[model samples]
Target: MHTPKADYPLSEIRRFLEPGPIVLVGSAWKGRRNVMAMGWHMMLGFSPALFACYIWEGNHSYEMLRRSRECTINLPTVSMMDQVAGIGNCSGRSLDKFETFGLSTSAGGHVDAPLIDDCPANFECRLVDERQIPEYGLFIWEVVKAHVRPDPELPTTMHYLGRGEFMTSGAIVSRRDEFRPGNL
Candidate 1:
């Protein structure tokens, strides 16, 4: 069964329904560092590389990001699945998520937030705007810098559905390059 609001309700609509990369936002405040899983991210522009990700107002990571105006968005590989779930389930306010998940971190190029070393790719984001909605807030940012491991094969990225369910876009399927010169 489906309804119009399946993609409308901010709470009921399943987040991460669109399969993509698993982005972990690393943020720090004072001396505390926290990382959280976020899937509601998208590229809003290209020239300046503007991006936007949704954050719940109540989340500890959200608070840190709102205050710090800086974050590192890490794209984890398939090998880091368990650690990814641990970060999403745990609260940074109560637990040091980075340590609890056994994730290692390094400084980003432009932000103070630590970037997860396990991830194949990382994006350093600087806050551009924070728009408050009814329940969730959207943090608009610009991709200040980026880093990618020099590998021939790309790593699989994870995505979140609802209720702890996740999926990974595995293998490459392409028809764009498969076209042949044929008389149609």
Candidate 2:
């Protein structure tokens, strides 16, 4: 026997709907550079490697990203949860997040945005479309370059569950044999 289900509030649906890893979005315009914690993003394509993320118009990084037309997605490990939450709670307009958080960065090869040196993986991307920004605040990007650490000791990542909760990535389970070559 199973228990009956109850409907949750519409506003609380995001806790269950959002299930992707959190990322630090880095952008640069003029001489200013900023990094913002972002949990609303997803992969759109595979062959060319495309991504889409939503950035509110009021965010400090919004204008910088729009003006520069490029950004970097830095994947932080589970251990960096405190910094991730801290970055999301504050605006990047007044303080330099990199310096405040003691983050190190390196220049991206294909874009002006700086990649977070502490992250195990960083993707350099260029904005490809903004047709949905007015209605959805969505930005589509094409990944131009990808950098990763040769070996990661603490590779666990975190996924937000709304509010102040987060779920850490755990053991890997693969179904490689279940898929055909063409499907992969």
Residue-wise lDDT of candidate 1 within 103-170, one digit each (tens)? Answer: 87887758999978777667778898766533558888887776666463355778778778878767
Tell me the tens digit of each residue's lDDT in model 2 across 1-184. 2122222232222222234789999999999999999888877766466789999999999999988999998888888889999899999899999989989888877899998877777788899998988899999988766666545433688988997999998876679899998654
Name the runs in model 2 displaced over 4 angstroms. Answer: 1-19
- Superposed model 1: Cα runs more than 4 Å off: 1-19, 132-136, 177-184
Q: For every model shown, what is its TM-score relative to the native structure?
A: 0.81, 0.86
The window of 10 residues in a row where model 2 has the poorest summed lDDT is 1-10
